[model samples]
Target: DVEKELEVQIGMKQEMELAMQMLEKDICDKQDVLVTFRQQLDDVQSLNHELSQKVQGSDNVIRQKNEIIARLEEKASQMNCTIKQLEQRLRQTQSSCQSAEEANYLFKQEFGEKILRLQNEVDLLTKQRSQLEMGLKDKKLSLHSDPHRINGSEQVKADQQQMADMKKELEQLREENLRLRQAGEESPSNGIHQSSRSSAEAEKERSTLERQNVICKLCEEEVSVTRLKRRCHNCQAIFCSQCAINELPLPSSIQPVCVCNPCHRVLLQQYSTTPPP
Candidate 1:
């Protein structure tokens, strides 16, 4: 019986050895699978890093494009403002040129009228001078023919006085003619410069000179000087009171500030068409 028990124990030992061998083989297969999984995980991590770098580069390119667009928009706006300013300046220049042309035309018309009026006055004066000369010749002939009948007669004395007064008037008229000729011969630039004086300043100077008994510029006749008399605001020349009343009449609104016919015409033209400031 003891022999039989020993045989059974030996058989059990052999079965246990076989089971241990099978467990060792299964453990070796599982280790191989774990190594393959670890390699795959490392590859995935490398790919993810490369993708992140590409995304950052794309973001930088987009940011640069946005900045360039903003700069182009700002430059366009500046160019628009500059173009508008240039257009406005061009319009202003055109307006100024038109105004200057109108002023030049008016000045020419006024100058032509003045020349015509002066010519007429000269012709009238010449006719009057000739008539006076003929009257003096007739008077001289009568005086020589009746020498004895002159000194004692009142009519003879009156005739002599009248002759002296006429001679003096003729001399005065000649002087006035010479002066007019000189004034007409002056340069246009000089005349323009003289005319540019402010009217208010001219009036002030004229008033101050009136107190000093200023001579009449046209007729050369001495008279009481006042603002009521005819005066040229341009040349600041006083005219004889008798001539002023007959020849140059002042506007009611501009009373006591009488301008000559030439000056009055200029003022009328300047005020009529000039645009309001």
Candidate 2:
């Protein structure tokens, strides 16, 4: 019985040693798990710090972009206003140009009509002068043929009176011819007396042609428009008030509504019975 009791004691001692070794291995495994958890926590903290820095940079970029957009919008508004002002100025300039063109066209039309009328009058005067020259030649021939008939004192006296009248008419004709020549020599473009040019120079000419329907018989100059009193529409005659009173013919016995001289008798008369309103 003593041997059996000793064997039980030895078995109990071996179990106690085995239990102590298991407890030591369990403690070492728990320490290794705790170290792994701490390393994972450190990695998470580093990632969070980097993420916060990226978010801050993104916010700053957004703010700068918004400011740039605002500036661009402001500049666009200014450009739009400038464009509108330019359009308005362009429209006004076009209107002014159109008005100027219209005025120029009207002036040109009036001047052209006056120039044509003046040319016609010059042609009529030239024809009259030519006819007078023919008449003078005929008179000279008649005078030469009647030498014997004009030898008597009474006959000579009559011939002298006729000759004097003819001389006066001839002198008037020469003066008229000289005036026409002078007018022809004066350039329509510059109003200066000059030689004639070829047809090509006509393209470059700028003339201001004026009309004159009235001429002074004594001075042989154009009558002043400011001093004109009566105008004959048919003959286009402008006469001073005194000249019209003295030159107009009067009826002998019967009183006529209108009295006209020999030159204007055939023309349609427009008598001014009253002053202009």
lDDT of 1 at 18: 79
lDDT of each: 0.55, 0.47
In candidate 2, stretches whose alpha carbon ends up further than 4 angstroms from where it belongs are: 1-27, 115-277
Where's the lowest-lDDT run of ten residues in candidate 1? Answer: 246-255
Clashing pairs in 1: none
Off-target runs (Cα >4 Å) in candidate 1 are 1-26, 94-277
- Tens digit of per-residue lDDT, candidate 1, span 116-195: 44434644554464465566567666767877765534554565566566556645654554454344334231222212
lDDT of 2: 0.47
TM-score of each: 0.31, 0.37
Could you give candidate 2's per-residue lDDT for residues 1-277 as a string of tens digits?
A: 8889989988988888888788888878888887887887788888888889988999899999999999999999999999999999889877765654454334334333443333334334444544555565565566677655444534445545665665566455545534433443332312222344445653332111113455643223455553334443224454442233212212221111121122232311211121221
In candidate 2, the residue pairs with backbone N, CA or C atoms under 3 Å apart (3 or more residues apart, or in different chains) clash, namely none
lDDT of 1: 0.55
